[model samples]
Target: GRISEGSGEDPYLGSAIAKAMVKGYQGKDLKNEFTMMATVKHLALYGAVEAGRDYNSVDMSKVKMYNQYLPPYQAAVDAGVGSAMTSFNDIDGIPATGNKWLITDLLRKQWGFKGFVVSDYTSVNEMTAHGLGDLQAVSAQAINAGLDMDMVGEGFLTTLKKSVQEGKVTEEAITIACRRILTAKHQLGLFDDPYKYSDTSRPKKDILTAENRAAARKIATQSFVLLKNENNVLPLKKDAKIALVGPLANDKNNMLGTWAPTGDPQLSIPVLEGLKNVAPKAKITYAKGANITNDPELASRANVFGLRVDIDKRSPDAMIAEALRNSKDADVIVAVVGEASEFAGEAASRTEISIPQSQKKLINALAETGKPVVLVLFSGRPLTIAEEFNLPINILQVWNPGVEAGNAIADVLFGDYNPSGKLTASWPRNVGQIPIYHSMKNTGRPAPAHQFEKFKSNYLDSELSPLFPFGYGLSYTTFEYSAIAVDKKKIAQDEVINISFTVKNTGDHDGEEVVQLYLKDEVRSITPPKRQLKGFKKIFLKKGESQRVTIPLSANDLKFYNSELKFVAEPGKFIVFVGGNSNAEMS
Candidate 1:
């Protein structure tokens, strides 16, 4: 399944999906000997990769770490996920695989996570590259950091015993880790039947059932974010002459996106198939305008490493001309473009995050046709699309939805469903201004207001901001936010604060709105971010109907790590903002 299958980019969404998937995989009776173990992955600061590159190092204040990245993982633990996977990147100058504060103090002690931690693929060995130490030293460090099992890396099996003998590691730690692994095995009923998940008959009968495919289609539709829908170009008419032009238009393999362990690309449905399923009578013309990627380096590596696709032999310019010729008289053009399956997964990080030149050329050619263009983007990480945002084309960000991706994309395009997905990571204007997020600490020398002097912290060439802020997404219908009322304008310490808002579906069509509630510390021992996402609610409403969404702010929600690195909520005034996205602030 696609990573999107687990959640729709919200921590609350992730928590809900985690509970459902855990319950679906492992029955309500977890004690049953035949239940499966679901593992929540890349525990901390893993989603906000610098420039959307996977496995990149993460640098953030301790307070930012606890406030933003830790919530979903903590929610996963609270959901009772059977296992937790450590991240590949470093947190606060220490590799997450070997960070004692991250693995033990924060995750285990503070969060009360009872599950064992598994190292990301060979992450224990990669610790040496992260400047931690040698293999033996990093292995010992990771074990001591509360990591239990080593996935595919023999770092633990190879050096742990010797480190124990040399007093670098304690025998008790080894016993605890080994016993945790044994306990997991026992929990999965592997002791009763070691090959429970290995049932060959189960794969044929249960892996991709009709009901599962239906669920996949529904989930995929919900995960799509309608980035641009100018003049209502979407909810496309079924009888129109549609030209589906691009390499991925009929690609079965590329539909599954990235990190789909059990997804069979060969059996996956393509966008063309999905369009046909929804608009069977529509006059559709298909053209493979360009490959998912045209870079030689990416093309060569993609085939050798990840989900390989047949490379186009002709030049990209020639292919674009052919596609342009095919779309000369079409009523509308649907351009399917973006990263390939391998371009966004682990070790597939890119320094530059824009559509390849070849695909851009194809889009430019299609744009000249004077036909309304609908652009569908399939990628795992967020892309910097400043140039394309204001184009004459409608855009949708579909993050590598799983097996029934084609069908889901078609469903949204033909008005069979509405898109509700929102971004989980920030989209920067350029790669240079990366490591940008909605929640960032205030430095001593902050950027001066309306000043570009040398002493101030302002950028000379570009704006020090993100192109698309977090918690940002557009629905087919518009919604209005008002009635920003708070229960208490002033509160004492340890008292709960309640914030309420009125959200109405003001447009013609029904839609879902994510009501975001942010809090800012007026005065504290240590300065907090400009604002922090304290609470959010995803609500669905019918056209012309209004709903009241209430968010509770607990004492813990306002707490932050002070100068001495202690979590505490200072007694002070806090600015409460209830709005749509990160930039939508109120007091």
Candidate 2:
């Protein structure tokens, strides 16, 4: 459910997923009676939550928001999502629910999003928490902000009428809101047939149908990231004996991860099932190496949501012994480990973003077997996998890839599909560096690579760098990036600069690459990130084939808010860098 609602962190991946989801929910014909409303959620910067916690406040510069967070939402809007959900966080001291600039001036007037804006559950009421105003005042403010519907909270229905009568809001505002609602209802053909999507027959036949499952499987496989592929150990010999270790080896419940409302854990095909289906002749042995959580309290909490976390019934040493015994004679050991279903998603925040100690111990013991270890990670959020990078194992980050996750992992491991998905969020080495992103503000004295000071803008314990930067992903095939060339080095006030580059697939296999474009405001009234992502393009290419990708930059892309909070694009020498990821650069 979380995967379907919002784009998972990466703008490129999110854009692709958004397009697919919108197409899946609402067919080519917008007037279809059975069409489901695809809502682009949290409009902006909701994913940049402090400490990765839900309902946390977000404070960001307008340039950062526009250059980073708003693009994916804009991509979704461009894909024609039926509706939008306003976030709970505040932007520049104004609650997103009542931010007129964000809702009206930006989304509606600027972006041309005709769909109505619905507040997150009780978000309109939560305006009081955001120090906006009282219920009546806030509701009026939100309505005037271009919010059309209030979800779950009767804020709009209850206070809008009173606000309009009291002169705090105009009747025209209510009519506009109602008109957007009615227009969406009209587009969905809801008035023509109110009972269209409500049919009991379609739910049985269409929901999680074979075709839908196939699509999910294909998408999930593509989403997997093959982090390491040492000595070409993958695509295990079909007839060789394989050992699948860890508690999640055959567990179906953990395969779906979190926020999967309609996902049936029992019906899910676990990694064991997928491997068995792909290589029926191979001897695949499994063992419950360790529980997901050693803490009984956490296990009990996880069990509340019907997740299995076998609370340490046996001693840790015994479990490790059993796992090591299982892996000793196997040609390859696939360590299926990571967080369970309740570890992430709304309110499921974590302080330490790493595999649990108990599971890590099991992995270490399995690694001692000297066999090639293939790590299949099941997670929701980006985890700190720096230590795993040094291990003599091949790791594939399969982020809780829905119901067919097991099958998807198997497909990628066995060369059915080459992993192409990249990291959407930066993986911080430690939890102290909360709210860290690639597009962070510059300080008066930035920390230089060689210069280290106590009061410097960095952590004393850990390096001032993300374990895995945003847009970081590895494919089975390799690609070579040539120097970027711009059509014009300098541009007039309204003139556009065409930046082009050549990306050649230098490997043997065909794969996709996310070409990234970043811009740096060398001179600006307000500070900006060292480099901010401005544009990106995903392209597929065959081996030895080169594609010339071009992206245009306008005055708007170079703009920043001044001291008076006015947006202006200062004319100066701007450094344009084009590459594959946050670290990749082309001068």
Candidate 3:
């Protein structure tokens, strides 16, 4: 439900991930005891916070909100999501928890969302901080705006009844909200037992079983991306001498990632253990090259709630010396370094989004050892890895890959599995390109796609593009795309366009590829994106095998909200792109 936080900013990825989660939780029946209700989160533009800070103000045009941030929420509702959580940010000029236009007009009436809505933790009371009103007024306003439950605020429990008595809120509104909550409880069979989910024996029977761990491992493997693998430095030999250096190499905790305060990190497997299990013949040695960071103020802020960031008793120089000493006898060095899991989660935003200076120095020293450096980078969001990219190193972008992190990583490192996970969000080269993505509109006098132009919509210090574009990932194996063919160059509303292409696995290993389809309304009444992802297929092929894939596009795919807010499609020339990623080449 908290989808807006972390790296899930892309609408397509958010929808797909939310759909799978909803089905996994509720399926077709909500009454089953094993099933749980899924909540789609932080409704209406909570992700595009000011300066990427959580719970900050979000201001944008209605059209941008409609086309960009609203689809994922709509997708969740369409997938039969059981609930929605209101955001802490303001919608237009009013808080979403008390905005009738957002929760009522747009969500319920226009989109026909049947589920009840809940406020973010303590958001109902916090609306007073947003200068809305006091507790009583905000609670009544939230109810009038169609919110059903007040989470952690207790504003509704204390003031809503009185507000109803005073006619500030209608009795009918309160009754309807209660009825929705009671109805959801009935659907979940909660009214029948009220204690079904709290069974005392379930923990021993279901928590972190071997079957669940296997699924976690598989899922984590699919979420990692190979950012760089120059000359195939990865797929290290089974008998190679590997030096694993970094503060996180031996950590038993922090692998569950952020916001899991109740998670039992004792049950999790660390990277050293996972590597030993998967590659028994390999000799692996580890050293704590650096802490999460060296700056005392930053470390103090990040390590408040847990032991995630462990500042060493030794100085930075001694730590790097130890790491270099260990790397000298190894065939290759693996530096498992990045921000601690606590650094990038909700309510914790950094002005500097990069590897910490202490760890960066350690990485440079490791590189100076002349050993092939493999950066097993872990982050909860995209960090500025430009400086590391300049150095000679191979990078594996692992976003704190869950409980079975080490085993899944070993699977890719030992060639038991090939990396296919694509980026759900774009990686910024620097903080200056913080909000960059693939679906931006073309400007007048647009800069050259490859280089900068003077007096254009370009930056002086960097290219107006991302370091790694959206939907970008790499695999141990290679894939080739043949020329694409379309059934017709132009089609009316009554006709569908059929596009076909072939993908061949040209390398010697079997792997999966995420084939993407992007469509652009080349000419429109209002300016549109250069391209938008319309369809994708994840296909697995054996070495030297080729598969012909077909995707169909209809009029509905091109429809957008016009100036009048009417959903309509303008007929004109269209450009279709099909390839391995968002930077797909059009045929």
Candidate 4:
């Protein structure tokens, strides 16, 4: 569930996205009226909690942390994020809220982060539960750790003054923390005018305008991933008779997604409304095929924030029967099915990452109708969809798209837009492959690409492959890669080399493609990953058009943290792979 909040499973991608987010949030200056300070939160491997559970202990070697988990935080710091929030979990046997090394040495000293540090909601007090200390001791420890602010709990507000009198925490440290907090407020112009950001006119002038919604609609279209398009069932004719069924098909509340607590759900468009708006000439029918989940306990947990998982009073069988009856006469069936918005967000973790059983039954019954089924899957995390993928149907992953959910769905359904988005995280075939990713290091007894070999690094029951690999996506149009070339096979450490390739639009649609490049070091001081994503470029092409794309490789791209924790590029034979996705074949 925590995966929903993070950029999917690769450090490089995570780093890039982190920098972009900081830039988007802070803009060119913090005092700018249109810009807001960005806070990089849950610092230090919160996403790597044990068994993907929230607030669980995290234990890892420095090497793993530096190479895999720490880059994004460093990138955010480099991008000048205004604040950092401590994670709930402990790091190296010390709670991150009170870990001096993490807050001062690594983040402030090593990374040169100028931002003030804040604790997660009540995290400073929660340290008592973590067996750290009582309110006063933990609060003192946190401030000594360089944390400038305490969120909720009020431990600092109530206990710090007494601690200072007792000499448990120095007056100077408290003064320093105060200075950092005041500096940030000054930077945001909060000191100049306390209500500067909350002007009454700001709502009407800046919030929820048509231009914002249009941009949201366009962005929503770009993010939809075409996971499967069996027998070219997608790009459906606008005039075709359609049956839209499932819990999320017409849910306005879930359209704004999980993180938007302040977003007005009523204003968000639903898929049913969107279909009519985009395809007014098409004959469309709608039915609630299934509840988000049939289990009352799960439904209750999912509805903690509100009525996200509304279980119908009707029996599961009755719900499926109604759906099948409605879809029977339609030319095609579009099933908007997956987790409710609350199923995968903060404090929400799932042992079973497949589609809910209730929705699975609805999908299975829809498949029996013999109409071409298109699964408009709504999920916050990559799901185990091997069963659905094998069925004769098309699948489009529309991950709980915000406000423009319905209009964006309609746009892609009628081929007004072709899906160019790719998966950043690998979709596991099953929960057993929880930690699968593209850059996994090669095992000593590596399994073959196909077929599982005994005594090899292969699963006994499942194939050694993800249900959907990282960087994998399908477009309505096909793209073919050829004529791969490198300007220089070898270059000095300071030199940059250009790798070029030809991409042709082999299918009959003008569409976009993200051309990705991966690199593998044949030999290095330490074990190297099978392949790591080095660079990418997004390009558009018309049918039968071909374009040459070039991406540069520099010394920084080749460097990695060795056993000594030094970043260095070892001299070796390196192989480069370029294609549509991470699973691209070597040239």
Candidate 5:
């Protein structure tokens, strides 16, 4: 479920988001009143946990790490991120919190990162469980490895002095770590005023203003991805009778999703309320079609933080019966369904990445209503909806929209805004394809296209394709790509190649399209993924309007980390692919 928190299965996209996130947090100046410092965390392959389980060991080659997993952290460093946090998992048989090769050698020296390093919650202390040593030894190891602060563990506060006195850790190393931390504090203007951000009066004046909510509403709309829209069932009529039924339809508590403990749930607008606000004329009835999950144990786990998964007093049959009863008199059924907010954050990993069986039953029943059914799916991560995809219903992935959840959803459903959010990750067909991604290498016995070949890299029960590919999203308006032109077919290592392509909005409504660029290396010292994302531009096109979008392919875009661990671009013929998504045709 950590995929929900990242840029998803590609290093290039991850790098772009990393830089943008740093810029957004740090702003132009470190001492800016409106800006705060950013911390790039996990410092290693934390997401690629074994068996897709949290806190599990991660093992992969250095080549894979440099070419795939390490670029985003490096990008964050280049963007001037202020602090770095160590991962709980070990790298090369040493816990990341105590791994000098990762923190001191690679991150600080090689990547030129000047930021202070901190450990994840109790991570330095937890290294003892990793068989490194006792609390004193692990704390000494962490300080030696360039870790500055120990969050919540107090390992540094209790043991670092003793370790330094005993000569286990050098005094100079501890001093350097302390200096780095103090430097960060000074940069944040904390020395001048220790309570700079803690003024009680600021909360009422600066937080959740009308303008702030309006901005939140707009941003939330842009984050939604339209996964599937069969027959354009969306842009629902203003006066249509809508049976708004689902566990989340009127619930505000889960609107903010996981990892947002500070947000006020009461302030969030529910889907039922948002619809009324957006389309007063639309006759919308509401019902709790099903609980997030019928299983008591699952609901208990989700409720660890709060009552996010509220099991109803009514029976499942009674709930679905009421939903059916409500839909009988409605022209359309808009079912809001997905995992509870607690289903996808830290310590939240599932073997089956699908909608809960309880909600699935409600969805199937709603589809049988013979009315136009639209699913407003809410989840922090991509869900396996293979069975639901085959249904004759439109699907919109809302992704646990924040404080303005209802209003943002209402805007997209009523065509006030066309969803322009493209997925940063791929949606798998089933749990069997757990680690499925777009940039997978084709093995020696590559599977032939559009066919089933024995002894090939193919699945007998499923296609090797994701249910929805990376960069995939649909707009109410359709687009057509053409006129792909390049300034030159060939370029030197120092030269820039200009590629331009025309995109036309062919549908009746105006919408935004994310024009993506992918590159394929014909030859390299190491094997490359079939394609890698090079660049992308989001452009708005009015009905019947065409725009020629150009993005540069720089010399650095062609380079990759070789077996010798050097960044180099091998001479070869390269293929360029430009389209709406990653599964684009060659240009």
Candidate 6:
């Protein structure tokens, strides 16, 4: 759920990934007909949405913006992303769609970004709600602010012409907006032939091919994080009797996840269907143990695009009873649970991101049967799963595993594939701790003995640590990392330090391990994070096989935006950690 599963979420984000995405989307030449222009979005801080709500306002310092958030947008711009979409939130006093300082000054003049700026869906019209202006006034303001295109709202199309005629908007701003649009069209080779994407013959060879589905299944395994596999309850026996129970057990509509308007739900194989196909010998009993939610309104919201999650006619108590009844005679209880696709992405943000109470009831009932519980969780964001930890269960986080959701999940559960995926973000202990992250800043007075330290930054109810940290994931096989060895502790300003570590597969099976490298600047001009992830490696290892991974850390890696907003790396001792996850060890 933490990973950006097939959405506009991670199109342009982090440090170098944004640049890589631009190249991947646009290819070598933007003018090439085959290449598509990528729209790098939000302009700034969409991920840091307040309370994790969609289109919520964000307030952060300039230093934090430049160091933490601004680089990705800058990178996408520098990488030549064809279009930049404005964020829904206001920057300073003006909405992003009408912020001339953001679009004209910072983006165009300062960064030398040549691409046209576009508004997010109905963002221009929504500006009136932001207390900016009515549609006609806001549209003219947006054009004056350097926005070349309006997405889905006809605000600019309807108002810009009249604003120009009335002298409310300058002819030059309109001309520039028009010129940029035409330039983008020409660069995309769309001006030559606008209806190229309307071709009828492309689907037979390219879309939904055997090779594509195979790759989807493979990547699905890679994105999975085995949260808890207590007693090795997973790697489920192919010959055992398993009860597959829950709303998501055989739902096709939820497989492709959110923002996939063109996806065909009928083509997706549900978990039950995949298990049957994967383990033909396994005795599988299936039941719609519980609806996604007890509330009909929530179900209606979730099924906006299609009925991914539906409210059952039967009562919750009856459904839970049925699930328990089904699991009584089974070797193991496999509960398919968690968020439906609509619960995430765009306006799909949740106030409570946890396993639905209805599904949780079913899961708890099944677990009470004294049978091993294997939970397959589906989500698009980090959910508060602390309640589930009290029970004996094996948790696998499979975030919207695309069209091959069933086959991929079947493969993992039955040991056809070993999960090698690591979490990209940290999971909080509870929903109240929504803003938690791995690289959080250390306090002047840190937690005293990880307990209540009065007059400190410690929480009264929750702990300082997260339930699961960034880059955390388990394997069917185990991995061990030896001590870290650096080429030299002290180096010249331009020199690089070579860090090396040995990782060995100490378990029975051959599997992949994501070896992470983290560092903490002991003292800095500004108080840095407790630890920042500098580098990582995903390597394959056979049983008892060891591999040495060497990562080169340049002085540039230690640099940060100072209080003066100048990027510099201060000379100081740094604590380096390297191991399986973000909570790496040196001792």
Off by over 4 Å in 2: 1-29, 60-67, 71-82, 91-94, 98-114, 127-146, 155-176, 441-444, 450-456, 483-488, 491-510, 539-569
Q: For model 3, give the 10-residue run with minimal summed lDDT.
A: 1-10
Return the TM-score for candidate 6, rounded to 2 decimals: 0.95
Assess every candidate by TM-score.
Answer: 0.88, 0.86, 0.97, 0.99, 0.99, 0.95
**Could you give candidate 5's per-residue lDDT for residues 1-587 as a string of tens digits?**
67667778889989999999999999987776678999998889998889988888999899999999999999999999999999999898898999999999999999999989999999999999999889999999898888888999999999878987899989899789889999988998989887887788988988899999999999999988998888888889889999999999999989999888888899999999999999999998899989999888998998876789888999999999999999999988999999899999889999998999999999999998778999999998989999999998999999989999999999999999999999888899998987888888889999988789999999999988889999999999999999898999888999999999899999999999999999988788899889999999999999999998999998899999999999998898899999989999849
Model 4 local distance difference test score: 0.92
Report lDDT per candidate. Answer: 0.79, 0.80, 0.86, 0.92, 0.91, 0.84
Model 4 worst lDDT run, 10 consecutive residues: 302-311
Superposed by TM-score, candidate 1 places the C-alpha of residue 491 at a distance from the truth, in angstroms, of: 3.2
Model 4 Cα lDDT, one tens digit per residue, 94-114: 999999999999999999998
Question: Alpha-carbon error at 413 in model 3, in Å?
Answer: 0.9
Per-residue lDDT tens digits for candidate 6, residues 302-332, read 7888787778788888888877777778999
Clashing pairs in model 2, backbone N/Cα/C closer than 3 A: none
C-alpha RMSD of each candidate structure in angstroms = 3.5, 3.6, 1.6, 1.0, 1.0, 2.3
Residues 74-186, candidate 3, lDDT per residue (tens digit)? 88888989899998899788998999999999999988988899999999999999998899999989999999999989999999778978989998998999898898999
Over 35-145, each residue of candidate 2 has an lDDT whose tens digit, in order, gives 678888887678776655678888886766765568677777788888998988888888898889999888888778889999999999999877877888888889888
Q: On lDDT, who's better, 1 or 3?
A: 3
| Lowest lDDT 10-residue stretch of candidate 1 | 1-10
Q: Candidate order by lDDT, highest to lowest?
A: 4, 5, 3, 6, 2, 1
The alpha-carbon lDDT assigned to residue 175 of candidate 3 equals 91
Badly placed stretches (over 4 Å) of model 4 are none
